[model samples]
Target: MRWSIEVFFKEAKSLLGLGKSQARDFASQIASISITVLQYNVLGTVKRFKSYETIGGLFHEATDGAVQLSVTDRIWGILQELVMIIAEAFQIDDERVMDTLINRSETFKHFINLDKLELKQAA
Candidate 1:
């Protein structure tokens, strides 16, 4: 399903307590990661459903009740692996990119919100 950028920013800003500029920055980072993930998903470097569902489920499960550092850290680790694979495929600096992307809490918030929305809409 196609996600609307405006909706992403709106939900992310609210959930992550991010300002518009920060939300935009986070959104950009997510877009880049998503593109890389999609590439990997298509190329069979990553299992489309397995990777996407795991990452997506992590966010939902993490946010369903309380938001904790441990949960967030675990989710971060999963994303880090995904990012590393993408970076390796394209010969880029995985650590630097992953570090930057993981800190964007707004991006994660949007991811969860969008995934929830997609699922609900599908149902």
Candidate 2:
């Protein structure tokens, strides 16, 4: 049982793309790790529902059945998930992410000014 658990970790990190990290910043790394953990949880949950021995088979069973989802719907869902994930990573509870960006670069400051102008116009 313990040996198989070690193999599972090795396979999960290598075969399942868990050990890969391309983030250039600390917050981004934290968020990427968080998202990876979320993905692992989802995969494990899907695996639990199937009797299949392979992870690919579990994915096939999850998506190949009734109620086929459209590509647009999936894209939208992915975008929404990324937004929520990024927001959580940014820890922007009261202030906008744009506010934080104002200190990051001149480009972000310009964008924040433009955004404020737009908000002023809307109000």
Candidate 3:
């Protein structure tokens, strides 16, 4: 269940640039996120039907569906993408790195510091 939601957010951010929008005006930024969510929801509903038709009004078509891949399979897919990104960033072979960062004892301090910084900025 968590994986499904994670995948949704990942797709939303990656495909639609939800939080990555660069609109200068506040209203435009809000509208940017709103449009991203709208696109995500519409595609999610359409994906439920296993048909990728681009016809109009199909966004309101029957939703409540599942992907062809299982949740575990989907998670593995995400992990593979992450691995590729990190490997390329680090100049390492894709197979050579089993990268774990936030959970490591040495990196937890940095994670907490970043979380604190984000919270402070948000507040």
lDDT of each: 0.60, 0.67, 0.71
Measured on C-alpha atoms, candidate 1 has an lDDT of 0.60
* Native-referenced Cα lDDT, model 2: 0.67
Model 1, 35-97: lDDT tens digits are 544533343323254555443344355467665557768886887789989999989999877
The local lDDT score (0 to 100) that residue 22 gets in candidate 3 is 77
Taking the tens digit of each residue's C-alpha lDDT, what string does model 3 give over 39-72?
8776766666866653233433423243367796
Q: Please report the TM-score between candidate 2 and the true structure.
A: 0.40
Error of 2 at 58 (Å): 3.2
Task: Give the lowest summed-lDDT range of ten residues in model 2.
Answer: 93-102
True-structure RMSD, every candidate: 21.0, 16.1, 16.2
TM-score of 3: 0.38
Any runs in candidate 2 off by more than 4 Å, and if so which?
1-5, 59-123
Model 1 TM-score, all chains together: 0.25
Residue-level error in angstroms, candidate 1, position 116: 26
Worst 10 residues of 3 by lDDT: 55-64
- Flag the better candidate by lDDT, 1 or 3: 3
lDDT of 2 by residue, 1-123 (tens): 999668666655754566578878989878776776676568677677756357655545655664866886797587567656777897754245434545777986786689899999999
